[model samples]
Target: MKGVSLAPGDYIHFKSQVPLHKIPIGTKQWRYYDFGPKVVSPLICLPGIAGTADIYYKQIMSLSMKGYRVISVDIPQVWNHQEWIQSFEKFLDVINVHHIHLYGTSLGGFLAQLFAQHRPRRVKSLILSNAFLETRSFAAAMPWAPIVGWSPSFLLKRYVLTGIRDGPHEPFIADSVDFVVSQVETLSRDDLASRLTLTVDTATVEPLLLSDSFITIMDTNNYSAIPQQLKDQLSERYPGARRAYLKTGGDFPFLSRPDEVNLHLQLHLRQVGVEARPDLVQSIPKGGTGGSPSKESDKKKDPDDQPKDNGGNPESTSEESQLPPSSEIHSLDDQLLSDARICSMGHEDAIILMQSQYTVVNRILQSACELFIFSLLPIYVESSYVTSNNVWKFRQLM
Candidate 1:
């Protein structure tokens, strides 16, 4: 077959614009797209079954332009979650990422949750789209799973295409479906079998115990692949998670409704303190020029009328100058230190109290330091100081 040519509006075009890179993971070579600045924490996007990292080209382009470092990968042919997690960890290490904000769709979402469960501290936030905790009615179809492995590539591609042909008729969605079908055609039988095994093998794991991480679950109300019961269960599992529902986008909301999906995504990212650049944001039309508010009251006011640094009252600036300087404001740090001093008998006592807290913090930090320390003597010395020494002795030394 000749190469498929994608239109400029197609997501595949964006995917092609970004160069792909290969990273060696043991005996296998994994293909990935790593774009955006290196300084920011990466937004690692994992695509659903039948999706390569290229499926999220829209997200990569949109988010990366907004100052985020986005990375997406082709799932290495690993059947079990443990192997997938281990290989992914090694891949992150090779790329020098200690922590990341994870975004995944469908099967990829399952993997993302597993990865987060395995390394909760390493995940900054999680975005799950059209994903479920386990296989539902799909497992019943697994009796024919062996057939998928033995079927000709053309037949497999046709089955996948036929299944998703009922999705929204948007040009981008159609393009994406074709692109995904093409990707499926290139997959080896072993790869297809492993992916199928992954789906069936997936089961309900314990709810993540992540208090510090932000979790967003995005799905379309019309999604049929994952039942409503599963979605409710997911919500019950993550009570604190934010949920965004589109009225209609079927199984692949990201492709069918990129504008809405992007809006929800940007809002979620902003809530966690990551925002797109002003220039990049302004470049995209509000609501993608598709829908508009019908009421005159819904119209946005002129930019000039918006509140400025002076709080929309120029005279307030002069009044503000009469107020006390910010430096004079009493802060929690100052109050805490004052309390520490008051609780002590003298300067020595205050110093000792502060030093004790520092020592405790230092001891806690040694765990992270152990990552780099190779020598046995250094480890023994640090361990001995932490375990054998009394608090009184440490205070006296301080």
Candidate 2:
């Protein structure tokens, strides 16, 4: 809730930068940041529980630099999944965005899936990062429902922060976490409780079956708030989803690892035939353009002249175009591995690795504190005389 201050020159720069827009949806106003060109299929960013549209500043600026329209939203205070989806659809309609490429992190990722399932035709692609299918495990781990609605706002904010503060020691991650915590502090008890309810509420989600829409799943290598089991479940649910791993950026990689995230995004966009902005054409390095056909003239070739796959999409005739040139794939693979090492080690090793990093030690400690606090919650609830009837009453109120 802290306002960004700008000097005279800074004010000019800030205004030239992405400007925030407020759209009225029914009685409530939805705030958002819109960037990049209006022509392309816009990359709509949806933030997690502790996020606002501003948190995606790095991604918006970076992706826009590469010629993609990007928009990030401050989700309205709507708790019901179906209602939220309906409101979101109306929001998009108001903005005149017929189709969008979605980039959702954590809670936002879950909502993105719901939106896509509910309105599949409007989605061009999906990028789900550090998100899961359901909240059963999370709800079981932290049984704060009885107290969440009545607890002091700071306590609730602290609890939320402890759970998600895990990230590398980078300044960007630290600053982002700090900003999120600040925003969290501004939430009223009702707002916090509503968000918590939304987090744990169960809903059935079917597999998103949009063939034309590219699907990519991104997660951090070293640390993830999302469980491995949930990640596996997502893969099982979306079989065609291309799995991309980030080496170091932890929960909020878009802020921490913009370059890498942007690369994958650019490649995916090219694969689906979204054109880059003309001004940013030279930003992509020479020799690798995600194997997209370079010449616009090539797109007009005769059907007979074009090679066809079994599925009938155009197939590159030459070996160089068949797949990303081996060199490019190798380079990208090496970068991915270097940036995000997959977690294949034991729990002890993982803990040691996490603790050894001075930058991330505080984050690990915060998570530990969260778990410790969670352990004490049941006792606190018992002492506070919170009963099943009280829980039922609270649920009804919600």
- For TM-score, the strongest prediction is 2
Q: Per-residue lDDT of 24-127 in model 1, one digit per residue for the tens?
A: 66965577766554444567889777877677766665555454556788888886788888988887765556668888887888889999898887887899
lDDT of 1 at 175: 52
Model 2 regions more than 4 Å off: 1-16, 146-151, 166-172, 186-190, 279-398
User: In each prediction, how many residue pairs overlap at the backbone (N, C-alpha, C within less than 3 A)?
Assistant: 0, 3
User: Residues 1-398, candidate 2, lDDT per residue (tens digit)?
Assistant: 11121112212232343445665669656777655544456788898877777777666655655556677887777767888889898877655566788888888888998898999888878888988787777677776664555677777777777787554467656644555665666667666765676677767567776662488888888776678898878777777788889888867787667668878787888877777564533333322221112344234432123321111112222222111112221244554553333212224543445345644766889999999999999998896776776888999999
Candidate 1: residue 142 Cα off by (Å): 1.5
Candidates in order have lDDT scores of: 0.61, 0.64
What would the TM-score be for candidate 1 when compared with the true structure? Answer: 0.63
RMSD of each: 26.5, 16.6
Candidate 2 minimal-lDDT segment of 10 residues:
317-326
